[model samples]
Target: MGQKSLVSTWHYLVALAAFLLSYFAGLPMPWIIVGVIAVGLLRYAILSKTSKIDAIPGPLVIVLAYVGFMAGFNHFHQSYSMAAIGLITTAYFTFLPNFALIFVGAPLIERTQKNTCIQFILSLVTASVVGVIVNLACYLGIGILFPSGVSSWYAIEPMALVWVLFSLFLLFKYKIGMLKLILLSLAYGFLLFLWRLNKMPMG
Candidate 1:
């Protein structure tokens, strides 16, 4: 591991660059997407004769840990108790599926590493899956912290239950087009917000 680490020193540099670019771009959770694209470009398009992107040692994890910290603070720090962060983060077991998807996607990526455009496509998919994972964690964390309000919808509404089940099936069983799924979630979140606003009695 140590020997391999020395040769892959450029990995974190690319990661840092990705984070800065994400910050400037104002994209939510941009680090993973940027890092993935950078590594792909380096391996397939830029340095194809010299190196491969797989050497980057999964830079997504750096973004993952950063997101976790923010999740810890946003979800837990402002809650009834700070200690709930540990329990909520732990109880959700949200990272399990994300890590599982990463492992599952690893072997599949070998088939497309040689193509420049295809590599970025794969990177986008990877970032999308990570986004879903992190979103799931935060979602479950909210429920854990506020059970009555956050988790009760599924029980009262059959459509909600069906949608939740279908979403899980799509995310875990199916492996392609994750970016679409992320967009779907974003749209759903917006509609949910609007629905809540509509419920408010205005003066």
Candidate 2:
């Protein structure tokens, strides 16, 4: 219908404007949400007679994928020596919104499921983000336990290797939560600490 297409166009325009504003701003990205509210109160709610700003989360997911990819690339490619806790923090900021939306904004997406293009984009973003999280987790875990750097074939020790396997298992089997990921990372760090203490030539 003409009316449905018009509504979709409006959503895209608002999403694009907010996305660009946030990217160019010096402050954090959530300031984009504030800008959307201001515009909604003035132009959308009054001048344009648009009753509400329907947030099309497709754009948000796209941003998350980019941030996750950049974070993973930077953390790994820098000699792969970043702290596990540091990388976990980055994952939090990247995934938190998607986590929240799984309950709140998900229903809205289902309700307005007419746009096949949006649905296709959303599916790709979801799959890409999952891959990013898994890959980043593996790198951070390995880097934490192997500060000297891993081989091209990755000849990690047995105990540290188990932690790596467990991380992947949690990711694939149990829908790994944020707390579990952080705790597992800490466990890896602690185990590495014990290994160093044992390697001090036994006094």
Candidate 3:
């Protein structure tokens, strides 16, 4: 395989491994350490081989940095524990799929198309919609089942909104077809319902 393809494959593998680790470990020490190491390796390998750093959007970088800083600030005031470190480490896993989809998968989709730019935009929007649906389902199910315990729905809302709006913007910018527009609208409606049910704001 070519260098790019190799790098993409490695990224997918790393994402899958981190996801599995997070799923089984439930924000514990070993899993957190594994996730951090996996992310570090993925970033380093991509940078070294492709000379392409993950071009995270400026807004996302700022938000993540702020979150990290705040978390660190909290740690400074309070005693930092393994549990806190693990939670923060696990939270980083959330971005892997988003980054992999847009950077690794979307480029391949673009390359395979005659109208690469248009296809890339469409693929990205579709993936974002799917991601939103999956996350919504996850959070809603947890809320319903637990009813009173700690829930992830509120925590993930901002990131989900960002992806949804970004996807919508891409759709408008690319002038996606009416069929896709309708489908995306329905997906958004479902998302709204879930948000309301979970007592989370749409944006």
Candidate 4:
């Protein structure tokens, strides 16, 4: 299969996994609906003919950024308005391969274009600046509503730590060609769903 096709397949599989596992997890229906819409939008953004980067799909970027963002919020009490979260997420995914490629490297994308390496650097800088600006604006306008407290996902579910680390490992190692990332993430998501389901009261 072609590179774009492969990337799309990966995203489709993962998105489906996330949707189903999230439903089984007993997440609020609204949250699952929004998540599906977000994935659909990311899929459209990355797959559109006008997309700049070929190898790195938008949903991968979203997942990496989201994991990092939630990790911070859950651990450090780093609270921000939903607007700021949306802006940050939008900026990272819109720019394509922002932080994910920074940590993972872009061997596949680099092979596709003559100047993408430079473009990658510039895009990273731009995304960072935009993220900071929007975050500041949100803080100044609405203020960061600090929560009373929040449990870290890893603490609440120790397996989450393993799941995240393993996901990042495969992503960094470029094992995605084997669909290891999708499969492993789906496995982890399913396990997470079961964990959450078990915690819910018997109806």
Candidate 5:
């Protein structure tokens, strides 16, 4: 099998592991979904005509970032087990999709002569939107099943904001289509309004 096929197969296994672990441990389904999505995107990129999957840097950077963030969070919040788990899970799953983007889809995308930069920016925006929607659904489902009394909106609002900021950065850097940018911006603004209304002061 080709390197792309090998990588795609490995990603599938990793996603399966994530799903099983999350399901049995009741850790969180969103992370598993993210893992699956990452693997799926990686496979798609590898099989696509453009062959952009070769452009992304290795997973080293993302791994390092995850480790560093986890270290810092643990250092600051050692006593908070739930908070630590949430942070670690979020950080780990956040970069799984990037693995596909950078390793499988990015290189080919970068080399394209037809507005590659714009395409990259648009892809980020699209990914952010998808991530937000999926995560929101996951959070709501978890709340319904557990009834742990956690606020679903509060749980997801921060991550959604982070994705919005990321999308905004891409939009600004690459000068994506005006209409899409405006829509993303408006969506972000609406999310922010909701967050502010629900936010309790961190005393």
Candidate 6:
């Protein structure tokens, strides 16, 4: 296989492992599977040169989504640390090919070298901070405002917050169309509903 193929394979492996760890660490099976599939598809899209937007990497998405998921559900438990490790791993992968490309220039390769460890670490930290702050603010703010009531429906799931924040960021930063953003937000809600279908009556 070519170097790029190798790197993509490695990304898939690591992403899968981290997601499995997250499942063991308390993330539900359905969410873990969805997370892995989403990241895998994003990787495939990037490698295939079919992705129109490169500003949102799967690792960053995972971090942001997970933060929102935690906040919305308040599901912290004994496996928090393990789940956190999985999140960190996902974030670390965000630095591969350098985060500089996220803002400008060509798409980055799915690979990072030892010489750029400092840059990788810094990017990981930065993305983690951004993810936490953005997701927490949206989820917690909605939670506080609604508290309890039919209005609280908006604050009940991480899916809406996750996709909304990411979609809005992409819409503004990269200028993806507003229609796409609306579709994504709707999709996120549907995705959440499907995931909960098994646990809730009529989902």
- The most accurate candidate by TM-score is 2
Segments of candidate 6 deviating more than 4 angstroms: 1-157, 201-203
Clashes in model 5: which pairs? 52-108, 53-104, 53-105, 55-107, 56-102
Model 3: runs farther than 4 Å from truth? 1-59, 78-125, 136-147, 150-203
Candidate lDDT (C-alpha), each: 0.45, 0.46, 0.44, 0.42, 0.46, 0.44
Writing each residue's lDDT as its tens digit, candidate 6 over 83-191 gives 4654454456434323443434322323443448856785775665466446544433454334353354554545445665687689789998867766775676578
Structural similarity to truth (TM-score) of each candidate: 0.29, 0.35, 0.23, 0.27, 0.22, 0.24
- Candidate 1, residues 1-203, lDDT tens digits: the string is 34244224324433443343321222223443343333342332222211222222224444434333332334343443433442343223334544555567667657667989987785786676577546545544343334356555453444345556667888889863767776776687579769989999999
The digit string of per-residue lDDT tens for model 3 on 1-203 reads 45455335434543553543322222222222232223343333222211111111123323233333333334335434632542364346446654555565666655667886777786775666466445544544343334454555554455346645666687889977757765675687678778778996557
Estimate the TM-score for candidate 2: 0.35
Give candidate 4 misplaced runs (Cα > 4 Å): 1-156, 177-179
Superposition error at 134 for model 4 (Å): 15
Residue 146 shift from truth in candidate 6, angstroms: 4.2
Off by over 4 Å in 1: 1-146, 149-160, 172-174
* Model 2 lDDT per residue over 1-203, tens place: 34344335334433443343322222223332333333232332211111112221224544333333333334345322333333443345445543564567668867768988888886776666466445544544555456566765456566767777888789899989967796777777778889889889854
Cα displacement (angstroms), candidate 1, residue 27, comes to: 24
Q: TM-score of model 4 relative to the true fold? A: 0.27
User: What value of lDDT does candidate 3 attain over all alpha carbons?
Assistant: 0.44
Off by over 4 Å in 5: 1-79, 111-203
Q: What root-mean-square deviation over C-alphas does model 4 reach? A: 18.2
Error of 6 at 61 (Å): 37
Q: Sort by TM-score, best first: what order?
A: 2, 1, 4, 6, 3, 5
For candidate 3, list the clashing residue pairs, or say none. none
Better candidate by TM-score, 2 or 5: 2
- The per-residue C-alpha lDDT of model 3 at residue 165 equals 67
lDDT (C-alpha) at residue 64 in model 4: 35
